[model samples]
Target: MKPGLLALVCVAFLATLPPVDAFAAPAPSLPEAGYAPLKMTIGGETRCLTADGDETKSWQYVALKACEDGSRLQNWKLKSIGNARYFIFNEYFGEKRYLRTYSKASSIALDSDTSGYSTMRSWEVSNGALNDIRLWNVYSRDIGQWKTLDADPQSQSVGISIPGGTRVDVWQYGIDMPTPQFPVAGTRKILVMATHFSDETSADSAPVRDTVLGVFGTPYYEDRSARNYLMQASGERLTPNMDFLDEVDIGERPDACNASQILSAARDAARHREKNPQDYDYLFVSIRQWRQCPWVGLASVPGNWVLAQGSSAHKFWTWTHEFGHALGFHHARILYGCPPRDGVAQLGGDCTTYNYGKAPTDPMGGGGASMFPVAYQHFAGWLSDADVPWIKHDGTYKLDPLWRRGSAAQGYRIRRSDGSVLFVEFRRPSQPFETWWGASPYVSGVTVYVVNYAPKARSMTSTLVNTTPGSGRSMGDAPLLPNHSLDDTLSGMRLTVTLAHNDGAELKVEKLPK
Candidate 1:
């Protein structure tokens, strides 16, 4: 502790001291830093975007960034800066909203304040010539005006309609799936639950309905079914339409342990999707190793009907409906105007009576009818108009299917419309014999346009049979339901499909009399 030694030590320590901020990287400055304000399509209509010259590459002119409904152009966080750079958003449609950011920066040059958008409209870029990258957001928004968007406010998911007898086979790859290729909306998520079906359910106790995802075995939603349903629904509601995605069935696995396996499968599927350029989307699944107690026999949702150890009918239904969630169809809100029982609105609509009263028609909303066919075929995707035609919950032109998965994800061949061959695998799942006349809003009903075909579906001759209504079991007021089954043959030379609806709608169905 000598004074001279202490002074020497202090000087040495001071010499070794680190510089104040030498090694640290400096934060971006206000002018040099970037900000990401959210842009939203209020009602799936239009979104308003604003940015300053500082943030935009075009520092001289105001930058005009174009955005689509449910489509965001940047993964940005807001940083309050100048007056021209502020954040404001609102929703016009229901509750859902989405944001997307471009992988590359889009340059939008504006001349001035009032001329911001208008001038940008005439803005040009090139090796010197003008480019034809047509977009709607170049010059639309005012300082704080609400932007108008035209993208369809509906979501273009997928739709399904299978028959009770239609066998559930794993879609083998590198093989000819040779399906109808009705353009789908978003990525398709598959949920396999084969072990939960029952043979005795017969078509009798089945519920009446429409084409949609239906479940029969293991009650409505088991751990597998419920988890899959939630994942698909969440993705649909949250993620905007992207290039690729799908859900699939898992082999026999325990319900409780299925979560991890399902997540693993989704990851694998996602990786595989990269090969197809359809890899930029979301996926969900439930792999069943064996029936675990936590997930075994659980309700698909709340009051689902598919129970464990059922028949093929139930199993088929499960696949159909759970897939529906991935496809983007919300459950029928009893309050939305469905038949209410005892004050509680029943989702499955009204039940039809049948078979002496030994059994009642299903009321869960997912179809279970043996006749009338109008029943919601849990196996059917119950496509809504918005889910079809490649529209967002808010409408917009979907070019991904046409540009990316076009030839592979879709194609059309004309076989002289003869009874010999026509009506390829429609990919539509129905109850025994059901046909969808309308488009599902949840599916990409566009993309696939057919010129002509023979009537292998027999829908031309197939009439809706009005069967006796189930007595007390009947939920709908109709004493008769529509008959969907048919076995007939017809042919035609050519057919022109104008447009396809997303709700499993058949665009062109013209055939010659047999």
Candidate 2:
């Protein structure tokens, strides 16, 4: 066994094994870089992907914290690794480590080795929503989900990876992103069909039809109802392109206008009317008889049906509320507990659980006076870029009534270092269709909200940073008057109402120190 003979034997044995290039030379790099000041969310909490305030720890693993848009550590860029794969690199560390997910490992970490890339370090990016995207692990092919790192007392409130169906929405920093707005020429057309109980000989569809026409159609632009406000806000009118048909009696049976028969009655009435494919955007059944108590409105169909009683109980707000669903709007308040907490349930717009409908601010909450929340406006595409301005710097600003568009800021979204947001706006309680304010007369003023943009939390996360503590009913306790302030010392953000007049309110905001 001479040295030369042994070397020749080793070379032959190595040749018998697999080639070094057999696994493929990773993936090709894409030109994606320089995008930053973004936020990563999981289960409605902002992830803290930071280097622990220690600049020397470039080798440290990335973790999730409450979102802080101001932190350079949280900013990232996805450097491509070919085959629809990418390495999510933190901008702060300059490619020192890549965010590494695993096929079997529950936690995500940072890999320091750049030369030897693993499939776990690669990700596939796909659209999550308009101008939003989701990341999938190239190895596991599972979507990225977050689990709290709370078990480690030393760990900041950040998220660690757990693979599942949850997706994160990455937003372009410092812009009031546009909400979903469809073109006006393609506005949805809906037909309103009134129905009567077979036994109720005097019920007529005229009143119901007239109400729908009056509320949703004709006077909407002038009356300043929620519908009118939406029209002014989105520039795209919600004109359901309405049509009214004669009353169709639901057959003379004891159970004739019962819960089971309403939908059928609507179907029959819809068939009885002129069939126009162009007019099929939605179908509304106005039941003329009143016997039920649940007051359940139907919205199972995406662009159809706001079936409600044709009685006196059917108010303008109620009709508008049902239309909200027809227009693809869901309940603004779902999971509810308090500001900065996960909501407990999925109650759409109903505030009975918290305040017993005493001061319902939203039409969905059974209150008529309150304007729609900013989140709803955003979802409904009611807020244009001009309506909501993103504030990354400190400033004293004037806010107009959120009900209508104005020259000043209708609303300002100030991002904190933790990635939580502050929404400041002025609310004119006397705005049209806002009659619920009479119930809590003091609600007209400047309003500030803290927004949690995670899906589970985003629904209930738009809670008011109120100036008053436990003042009115839970629904009425958000708006702040002139000279009042709501401060979040932890986030280093403070909002003060300087002047509140009919024109608008002056607000001074202090963002977190850079």
Candidate 3:
């Protein structure tokens, strides 16, 4: 055979074989510098990333919308600027605007500038499971940590979130998904596990076990336990069953507070005893005091796990507060520093200061192990719709003590003009719990709270209206006493506590002329 014919035969054989790079590692499916829909699958439905309102406008809201083909607002342009960072822009508006995140608001919006490093415009894109991708703002990274870009399928909104647990969903680029649903109701099983470090020989398992059982198992209504507090707070909607796992030694020296490692060990120990941790709805881990940990108690927001360090696990306020977080509740906040008209601090005025866990009558506010505020109870779906009616007309309504089950109104919901809600409830000193140090004027009065309904918000969503502002009074005295009135200029409504007694209180809701 001729030499040229033999060479041609070799070339033909090489063409018949697969490409070399195909056998090598497949290139990452992450978005390159191109146009595509940033999609996420939530609740079995596909939602496409979309910019709300005018595309050319700056600071337009960004969210996930129903997937649609050929929709300009749904299409995003990924422009790489090296180092896995990208400047994302809406294809409808081109490069004039880019996706930006506001850390304070935990929101994503469109911006015009592209010069800042990671302040807003720059986003770091990394590969997730399979075709999924995770986005983090460089500014958040510079601030020591970054939250995940999470989506609420029910609300059709997207925001930055730090999940309460190890599990989280990463956005899937170029993939389509559907919408989703709600959480479980009624009885939820709770598992309590105690752990101690190898160096802590003084850590006793007996008292710790008793404390755990007392906090969750005690059935007496007068007992200051999470079970009793939640039962009253939930109006019997939620009944949590408590299960105790024998204490385990994690065999680790507490050099630093590593929650993940501690929780993993506790879960493994439960499995070793033929108990599956996943069988319970909530997991509570109690650990001995370690100086290395900066926090006494910690819990995942809207998550199922809670960690309590030291003797705090035994305290009613500490463990109950952590459990509140697991139930999807944020801290009860007090709004301060507002100009006072008459006697009340005008909440509609320029109130800038906010103090968390300052409302002294509610457990979520770091108060005694009392029932949660009316707003939180309402959020938990514990309040009946008939009991908490929306105030539409000016009228006097009787509000029973928030902790008691009664025929009178438990709370009132007033919708402000800006779409936010104002919840009004009466509080009185109850037995075992709701008994703070100063119980005279603070614990027994009509309390009002402005609740912003943002399901994905990480900050304090409820702000207590300070009835007695600039009086050098603490947050404990924030509730409106009998015969006192509050004029909320923002809501165009005036609330006056007409009468008060041991049974309940009378509130007058009058609408101001617009």
Candidate 4:
């Protein structure tokens, strides 16, 4: 070989295996000044905290590496509230240096070096931090104006998407409410319920009486622990089982329509199927706030149920509709985030479209005996072909295969006393993307593609997606590993997966995701 050619070969080989530092970045330097122990009471505790570096910014907790060995203080951002009022810290999941032993809404604080633990405040954190240390801006640019909550009233509150770090519990509903605050006025996302109530076998007659705790927010749903409530209208006993639609005890479901009897059944629905936040599909339970109108019944999350005073029967729609919101769905058929067009109409708060199944006839759409109305369609299930465009365009549900493959899927089923509702979710691994907009669009749980995706590999973590850079995310369905959704349940509806492998191989799935 020519001498120059051999030299080039050596250079190429060396380039492929650069110095160890090639993959390493500089460690954040500590401030010249010595640090001290600091302490702040959060919720109501005097924990101890230590910091090694001088605070980079005041009233703003920028990157604060806890004063522990191998901590990622400056690495993780921190917002310092005045006089260290709220040492808002941002720690990702599994970053041992940024470990959290408590839930965000519970009692907790950051360990400061100066005095002790910092004061307890609702410092936000994400499940999968992605090490995205970017700080949260002042205003929250949620999807619709319905999130406005009149602005100023909500200005002082933290604008967030991820539910990690810390959160202020403004309400007192039962277990499995939003697990966080309800924006301003104790209401987050507003929803409108337009449905036809069931009549013959199922009907929730008594209007759900609500005891709103105004400044205290709404009481949690889990606060009530009855096995199930009888639906006074439908005469069905709502069961507790938010795990999956299948666990609904289909065998014992009693079908009937009555006033007091259905009201009693409603109890079963509310208590059933609420999962803890640790579950993968935990995000699916967030409920906004609702209003009551004569012709409309409203529902919101966390645990504040509202019903129009005119007709208790109308509340059935609100029951199901609000439950839909808890799982991240707006009105069916309505064009949202996207501009309105033909077939779509702006209903005071949420948008609506006229393209759904015979909503007046479907039980879920608020249809049944004792009462009669249009039915709702099977619109809130796994992502459908028609829903993919919007899911990818708006990021409601992600198509990133990285998260799909990295984390396991978690499923849940929700129920109210009036009747039970079935659902499935692909939850974020551990703590999901907790950054402002970094969260995958799977807000209302996730719309997993049950068909048409197969990838074979030696288990690798490629740069599948990174949207925080303000770049449009890659467009492609997150690989649906085998038949997760299909095998998990049994229904008459047949599922077909036209899977395509990453290695230029076509595949088909007759199974489900494990």
Top candidate when judged by lDDT against the true structure: 3
Cα lDDT computed for each candidate against the true fold: 0.23, 0.49, 0.64, 0.22
Q: Taking the tens digit of each residue's C-alpha lDDT, what string does model 3 give over 47-118?
A: 888877574455687777888898888888767553234678888788888787655536667877555555
Mind giving the per-residue lDDT tens digits that candidate 1 earns over 1-514? Answer: 0111011001000111111211112211232223232333333333334333142332222112445344233222322222112121112211121111111113322212232232122211101001111112212221222122122224311111121323211111111111111112333332222221121112322211111233335332232233233323232322222122222232333345333344454454445445221233223222222334233222221111122222322343443333332222222211122243333222222422122211111112234221111112111222221222311121212222211123122222223212112221122223232222333211213211111211111011111111122224332321111121111112222122233322222323333223
TM-score of each: 0.24, 0.57, 0.62, 0.26
Model 4 TM-score, 2 decimals? 0.26
Using TM-score, give the best candidate's number.
Answer: 3
Worst 10 residues of 3 by lDDT: 5-14
Q: Residue-wise lDDT of candidate 2 within 108-127, one digit each (tens)?
A: 66656554337567655543
Q: List candidate 1 stretches off by more than 4 Å.
A: 1-257, 262-314, 336-364, 369-514
C-alpha positional error of residue 256 in candidate 2 after TM-score superposition, expressed in Å: 11
Each candidate: how many clashes? 129, 16, 5, 137
Candidate 3: where are CA atoms >4 Å away?
Answer: 1-184, 215-222, 342-344, 436-439, 457-460
Off by over 4 Å in 4: 1-121, 125-294, 300-303, 309-317, 323-514
Q: 122, model 2: CA deviation in Å?
A: 17
